[model samples]
Target chain A: MKQFSKTLLSIGTALAILGSAAAVQAETIKIALAGPSTGPVAQYGDMQKIGVMAAIDDINKAGGVNGMQLEGVIYDDACDPKQAVAVANKIVNDGITHVVGHLCSSSTEPAADVYEEEGVLMITAASTSPSITEKGHQLIFRTIGLDSLQGSMAADYIANTVKPKTLAIIHDKQQYGEGLAQTVKDGLEAKGISAVMFEGVTPGDKDFSALIAKLKKENVDFVYYGGYHPELGLILRQSAEKSFNAQFMGPEGIVNADLAKIAGDATEGVLATAPKSFDQNPENKARVEAITAKGEDPSGPFVFTAYAAVQVMSDAIKAVGDTDPAKLADYIRKNEFDTSIGKVTYDEKGDLTESTFLVYSLHKDGSKTPAAQ
Target chain B: MSEASLYFLQQLINGLTIGSTYALIAIGYTMVYGIIGMINFAHGEIYMIGSYISFIVIAGLLGMGMVALPVILVIALVIAVFTASTYGWAVERVAYRPLRGSNRLIPLISAIGMSIFLQNYVVLAQGSRDVALAPQISGSWTFGDPQLFEVSLSYMQLLIWVVTVVCMTALTLFISRSRMGRACRACSEDQGMTNLLGIDTNRTIAMTFVIGAALAAVAGLLLGLYYGVVNPFVGFIAGLKAFTAAVLGGIGSIPGAMLGGLILGVTEALTSAYFPSEYKDVVSFGLLILILLFRPSGLLGKPEVEKV
Candidate 1:
């Protein structure tokens, strides 16, 4: 029995050594894909995943970066702030030095602190809250434009193009929603057009009749909703049923095809300011084809931006010749790169130098066309 | 109608529409608690499953080019009720039946566990993203002047009202007249005595679950089409609200659930109309607290008499 115990111990030690040897020889850099993989907004996480996976696949196919293969490790934050912080810690503990996402702005802001403090490099592809980049973290960056920029663009369009007599502003009372609404309100006030009514609606509410009645009573000709698609879809459909004749607009959060599914014909003529559809870029034909061939959707606004995040990370890593986040952050801030979202240049605050938000009129058939600007 | 009246009337209509659905879900809670003296916490998830089943059935029928709306609605309703009823029976059998007669807290904990299990089950089966179905009902009847304000009764709202009234009437009649309903009443009144009298108390208890589940399924189909969106987590809040409705109406009283649902819905709508919409939940829940503090037995609930 003593001899058998000694043999078992020897086998365990040998297997441990073999495992370590294999891990050491792989020479892979792990990029953590952290986002909502199990909540209401998990579809947005899927968009980030599609973009990151495609980028990783293409990078590895071309002999990798700095002779090291890129690997993606997924972490589901469920789009909750607390969960994102936990995921950030898990990624740090797992020795992943780079992250491509913490998708929702509310989730991203908290996780950004952890990544910044830990000296981890994170380039969020979708979170647009300006407060994220405003914190001035050295290792934190984003490929998406901020809500302030998008809000200003929406204000510009509403003021200059689709001018109306009386306006109403409604928000879902969430951080992302309320912040964007405030920005748009500020921009509109600066333009000398004030909303007749400014109010908040609960996020998961299925009833909007009372709200609609108030909008009609207020005689608002144009309504701007600051929230994700679900509530706005119900509002739109309910508004249509009541024959409310107000023009409606929202931000990129309501730009998905699901809006049309929820609101049906009411989605027609609804305006949204979203990042220019990067999947349709003529330069991204090959990448788009590759993603589509794998039966994945490439049309989400975040898809190319997430792909750009991976590209920038790899390019910086290649230029710096090491996986050190500080060196990579320094290189990324100073250099320019061509990506699926077009030429990218970062400001000192790590936000894009130029904005990409544009106004599009959604149709019932789930297609969007650039509104006359 | 004057503009103020029109607005108030519009809010009332909206309130009643939402209230009726809450009443439907509340019945499941009230009936289950009445019989077993334990809250069926998983009742809400059963409603959610009903929504998913209806969504699936509708999507399938639409995919096969089934454009006849009434036919599709009927088929989805039948399947959702049947499947959700089965789930309701299974939950009671698997989670609550074995724990019966144990410490009341044991069954309560088992109920919570069952709730979590059902939620995760739906989440794993259907991805957590919101699945939207195109609004199947459209158009409405508008009243008052369009220039000042319009009070509109949507066709979907009308359907919800009609279905809810019919279900409530049928339930009232069944409970008052049918042999199974009498058995249910007997079990609720005295389970031990009912069993002593050779009544299958277990089957009666299961029937209560099945009946409550069927009503909830009807509600699920109605709201899923009304809102045109469903997610696995949607049930949690809806369940909570319905449970609140059940408690406020007198936890074990059938009519109390209906009254509580209407009052809560109207309170929410009026609060949103007058005050900020964000405070609507606070106002409704605040009303519940006031009721609990003042009328501990609920508006219609009889005071319990403990046996010596």
Candidate 2:
């Protein structure tokens, strides 16, 4: 009876060991998707989240990289830098090695160091400030282009294509807005198109009549606003109300349906510069189709880029055969992975090797159409 | 007129438009302070709530088939006023009334707390993003030639100015001629004495909040309509500016509040036009300091002799 009891205990221990082994083999790879999931800019974060979800769905359905399932965790930074650092710490504490996130530059710039120090691979989906990648962090990579490219493209279009004599450059004076505005100003000056007035306006200011009145006196033929939609919409409306008729343009920050809803008729004929959306490329039809089938809008500025980010990271993990963040970052930096958005290749700065910005005009119906080349 | 003069006149017009909205809100601050001797820091939140009420009403009307502009305006105004007044009464009952016997600091802190609470409550209920409304009023009338500087006024601005004047006149008449208005004045002068005389000073104070909140609602409604956008935090800056106007005009004087608001608005507009636009706020605040230095009682405030 004693021998039988001992034998039974040994068998139970053996079964427990086997179960632990199976659990180890079936472990899911955790990926963190952090952004402003709940604030004023929640819509922007949702676009990236939707894109990441689509990629994860596709990858897992096809049997995730190396037969391991990819599990995603969402962290809300609310586009706040302080909260983003906390999220980065949380991701590191959770032993997460891969991340595709931090939609705004304000959040991304600070969070990048935390991930880099913790040996985590990060791919920011939408932060465009040149300063973000300019630090040359080895672990940081972005799927989207820098504001420098977009700003210069906007200036070039304004100088050569639109060919206005005098321009007024206005910025919201925040980090992203001011950086983009300064770059555009420099680009315009290089082309000998000096702005009549370059000024900074406080964001969330309801009254721009005084500023509009000043701009009207300058009689500038063009107005380039480096801000998000709310203030831009107000500027457009107040300018129109004051009879300060000037062609208005803005950066990607102005690319929102809410702009039209706020500016109303003033939104008509407005132009903005943005990276090529997925819907614009014929090669992305299949990818776009799958994304839309998931009840998500695949046409947003970040959706395709976000998808590309996830795809590149997943492919790198497959190439490395392990979840070591250092190896994954090195692999991503060295390889040119084909993605739903296009080819993904990085420069030494971890930004896209080549990026293009296109000008889109607002139609009367609040939809944007790419301008004819 | 020269182009410069036309430009000056145009800026003045713009200032007056914004000034009228400030005046509407400033009255709330002044009136509440007059009777209660409390700032009613949450008065701005009342205005914000009013804007939200107007926004919801208009959206609801639009959803209910094809609605005409005038009908939408009337319904939105009535509903916004009623709802905002109720909020004011409730806020006073919950935040201020309990702390009435406490020192001034306690009630002041309570008012600030209420302000923050209301701001966050709206943010949670609505959203942090600005709610965009389609421009309901359009078509501006221009006064100058196309070649020279043009002074243009939109139909919305005209409506704002007219409504402000009518409201101001009505409030003035109510204060001087009405029995309730006299009771309010008596409470402001001496709440203890007024209470002793069977005037129901508490009721009068509550009424003061109601009146102030209603006036702020008008400001919020017109502000949303004029700008075509409203947000939860609109009250923070607007409230501060209105407070400055109230203090500049004479804290408890209705006429002083109006004068202060107009002065603040026009001065800000002119400064932005002539100097760097960033300094416009500085000039407005500077005017407040200057007014206080010369006449501490405010522009239209009566001199106060301290009774020993």
lDDT of 1 by residue, B42-96 (tens): 9999999999999999999999999999999999999999999999999889888
| lDDT tens digits by residue: candidate 1, A239-298 | 887888799999989988888988888999999988798988899999999999999999
Task: List residue ranges in candidate 2 displaced over 4 A.
Answer: A1-132, A135-141, A291-303, A306-339, A343-345, B65-68
Stretches off by above 4 angstroms in model 1 are A1-144, A282-350, B65-68
lDDT of each: 0.91, 0.88
Among these predictions, the greatest DockQ belongs to 2
Instruction: Report the alpha-carbon TM-score of model 1 versus the true structure.
Output: 0.78
Candidate 2 CAPRI classification by DockQ:
medium
Looking at model 2 chain A, which ten-residue stretch has the lowest summed lDDT? A17-26
The docking category that best describes candidate 1 is medium
